[model samples]
Target: MRRQTARLYLAALSKYCGSRLGKLLGVGCGNGEFLAEASLKGFDVSGLDVSADAVQTTNTLLGREVARCSTIERAGLPDHHFDVCVCGYVIEHTREPLEFLSEVHHVLKPDGVLLLVTAASGSRPVTLENALLRTGFRSVEMMTSASRVLVLARARVRRPRPLVSVIVPVHNEHRTVARLLETLTAKELTGADKEIIVVESNSNDGSRVDVLRFAGTPGVQIVLQDRPLGKGSAVRQGLRHARGDIILIQDADLEYEIDDYDSVIEPVRTFQCAVVLGSRHSGNGKIRVFADQWLLGLVFNSGHVILTGLFNLLYRQALKDPWTMYKVFRSDCLHNLKFECNRFNFDVELLAKLIRKGHTPLEVPVNYRSRSFKEGKKIRVISDPWTWVWACLKYRVVSPYGGDCTRRTENEMGDVPDTP
Candidate 1:
């Protein structure tokens, strides 16, 4: 029965890695059945078993020194030495599954494969699959056999798809909310996997109802904020619930084009910078708002230039439009920033804190169309400039260890309830 089981597992492993001869490491070579089968199938095999007697028996049976008595966590094996590592029915026995799997990960070559077999009766299967994903394994497959399940995961040495969280802050703009949501969900932006989290504040203008229309859509989450917190607050709320590898700020207003999302995220994907900002005034003719087009536009555009210049001077980073609504950053960057601004000053605080952490944001040219205040624009010309100036200076001196400024609620912020 043991030899038959070994042949069945070898068949499955052969399906993925092909019948090619390579090095294989078995975590628990009980009585040497599996490694013996691998050896017959043209693999140079080594193994680790907890029992010294079992190791000696396996070595004697194989007629070579193939099995070692060692724990997976402290296997003392050289790195990048094995092409495949097999842990059959051994993960549940390990006290530290993650650490043990990480050790396996460290030992495998760049394109190495890890095959895990566990009983299907308990929570072990689910827990093991989650552990594989969290440990930087690229592709994970779950297959079932008689009374057992197999998890085949491949090691990713370098690049992997970055999961993006698109935080859309919605207010009273009933006219464009639905269209915005459609654009976000209809097309795949950046060619990278992403999820949309819409944080809706108290909008009496039916914008909340419009967003609820897409509640049934996959990857679309509608978060309802009880009060009229500012856009910054809504974004902060979304950040707490985001599970993506990258955090991208999306505006609900129609001023920023959704088509620019690819360009905004490209910098991070190419590894040029950890943070990226979409600039409207980057000499792109596609930029819909020009200084000569509208007087109010010119004033705000000039203010943006001045503020961006001040950020460059103080932060020693050259960013053309620091206040641009389209900002894409790595999720880990948030660890250095204790976000407090529940309003427009959130962008200012983000720029200041990121600069203080010594990260320079790469600016990418993207299309933008400025909306007039009469067309549901929210920023106040008189007060916003002062807020931005104060936030930029204040965040530079404040330590991130001071704790996050926003409060969290027990509500399922990412839950999309039954669509009403």
Candidate 2:
């Protein structure tokens, strides 16, 4: 019966941990049978049992001093030292299950795996699963037979936090640029390391002076262009200087909330999606328009609906607010692609090309406060919509592969065509 159970434990380990074999600890290793089997399978095995007789028997069976007679809580094991831990029929006997699980958690490396075996009648799978989660285990799996339940879990691995490059394109609006910079530079706003790239396009409204104030600031790079270029042109310049794992686009205006940065970047950080767009109309059915400029708001909102619908149909997507300013994505996702649009149509071109390259963006709901033309809203109502339509059609049909017309090998940053 012990031999059969040892085989079962080994099988579970193989299924979860793959072919990788390393140091393994056996909790309450009875007579060293499981430890012996694990040792033969290329694992450097150690065992802990409270019973001195069992420990002696295990050492005698293995012909080595592998088993130690001590409780796991008082075992004096090194933290994050083991690769795999096998608790065979031991958890059910512990007085404090949470403490026992936590001790196990402490002894294993961040990427370590744990195999726990318990009697099916003694504990519920859901109860055990929850306890494992509380003890910092993720990717938990359970295998059940008629008599026993085998639980496989991995320790929550700590990956290095990614660097995020925030590209803020400044065009006029001195009133909000300084305040926006303050909110962005706050360290508590995000978990990832951040570098703020301010592309000042010779703003006539003193926005350049405000941006220049942060010139020597740590993690801030300021680029002063000779003349006022479009938002897309500024963003392209910022991209050349961006040195981040993830790239994010931010408008100089305060229409989008800085607080939503985490939510917008969460999908990319968690590896759930390659690209994320902070959609202002994700949950709200009503169109968000500037209340002060009601008539222009109505026209702009109507245009948004028409453009968004057209884009969705053309790209085979169901995205809400495709032209959102808050576009967050991994920098590598832009590899082998070229960007050309040098105006507001760049928004349409970027999203369309990304979709064509198989990166359907994940839309996350975000807070938005629309600003009117009087408040420095730069999008032209008449000509911009036509350009956006042309961009939607152009990028949708363009081949994503080959040639100077489609691909450019100039640099990893890709080519940005001059404004026509």
Using TM-score as the measure, the top candidate is 1
Candidate 2 lDDT over 66-112, as tens digits, reads 99999899999999999999987888899999999999999998879
lDDT of 1 by residue, 1-420 (tens): 177767766776777678656899999887888899889998899999998998998999899999999987777899889989998878878888778888888888887998877765674433454566556664554555335667677786643677889999999989898998888898686658889999989899998899899897999888999988898899999998898867889888878888888888877765557688888875532233543447776677667777878777877776767888888987655653577888899988876776655467788887777777777789877988899888877776775435532111113112212110
TM-score of each: 0.60, 0.59
Model 1 misplaced stretches (Cα beyond 4 Å): 1-160, 284-293, 403-420
Q: Which candidate leads in lDDT?
A: 2
Clashing pairs counted in every model: 0, 0
Query: In model 2, where do residues sit more than 4 Å from their true spots?
Result: 1-159, 187-189, 282-285, 400-420
Error of model 1, residue 201, in angstroms: 0.1
Task: Tell me how many residue pairs clash in candidate 2.
Answer: 0
Q: What is the C-alpha lDDT of each candidate?
A: 0.76, 0.81
- Backbone clashes, candidate 1: 0
